[model samples]
Target: MKIAWLTLCAPLLLSACTSTQTVGYGPNLEPIPGSITYGGQPRTKLTKAPVGSIVPHQFFDDFGHRVYETYVIEPDRSLRLTSRRIDYDIFND
Candidate 1:
């Protein structure tokens, strides 16, 4: 009984250990060399848009904190994106 519960809980605990790393923009900022400014996997080097995708997306900050990266894909397939960085401290930080 205890073993079964532990087994079931192990994966959940392990998955929570996942971490995020900063993509240092200052060093690699020359138009990102090959970074797709839009139509990518939200936060990685991926180029394909997400399935059933809608725009006005989001992302994170330098410390892997939450941020919003908004984008819009027009009917004619034109892409427009903007990034807004927000810290966890809402009022004063």
Candidate 2:
């Protein structure tokens, strides 16, 4: 009787230990080349974008740190990078 009860509860207990949330940004954007370079390197390449368009970019460093950047495309096809934090709140209120 005890073994049967344990078997049923074991799966439930182990499921909570699993990491359901994945690291880094979601599967929507791609990383920019040479963006993860060191400080002494040249200026990072700016992604091209059309006017009034928002582009999302992700960067990963050697220390496993991730950065999410949003760029607003100017009228001249220049990208303006912003380091704004994204809100993960499900409810706006």
Candidate 3:
């Protein structure tokens, strides 16, 4: 019984480990006003930076909030924003 169960589960476990998740922009990944890719990816594609390399950008949003963003270069030579942080400047107000 145990041998049969292991045989049944082995392929499932190995398949799970072998699956690769593709990273790309989705509906929820809409860029903000001051983002680098806000108006869509630049006509000039990155060549020197290898795929999976991280690029950081800082800018002030339309609301005057400091925004820090981290992006990764995809296989297609496009930048994909992976993480973002906003500084509200609570004390400055």
Winning model by lDDT: 3
Q: On residues 1-93, what C-alpha lDDT tens digit does candidate 1 reach at each position?
A: 999999999998876555333333222322122223533433432246653244554554445455544444444444444333344542222
Q: What lDDT does the true structure give each of the candidates?
A: 0.44, 0.49, 0.77
TM per prediction: 0.31, 0.38, 0.66
Give a tens-digit lDDT track for model 2, residues 11-90. Answer: 98877553223333433434344343223323544455447687776654443444456666656555555433332322
Model 3, 1-93: lDDT tens digits are 999999999999777543322323443566788888999997899999999999998887776667777888999999988877766654444
TM-score-best of 1 and 2:
2
For model 2 the local lDDT of residue 26 reads 34
Q: Going through the candidates in order, what is the number of backbone clashes in each?
A: 1, 0, 0
Q: What is the C-alpha RMSD of each candidate to the true structure, in Å?
A: 12.8, 10.5, 13.4
- A best-first ranking of the candidates according to their lDDT comes to 3, 2, 1
Candidate 3: worst-modelled 10 consecutive residues by lDDT: 18-27
Give the Å shift of residue 55 in candidate 1. Answer: 0.7
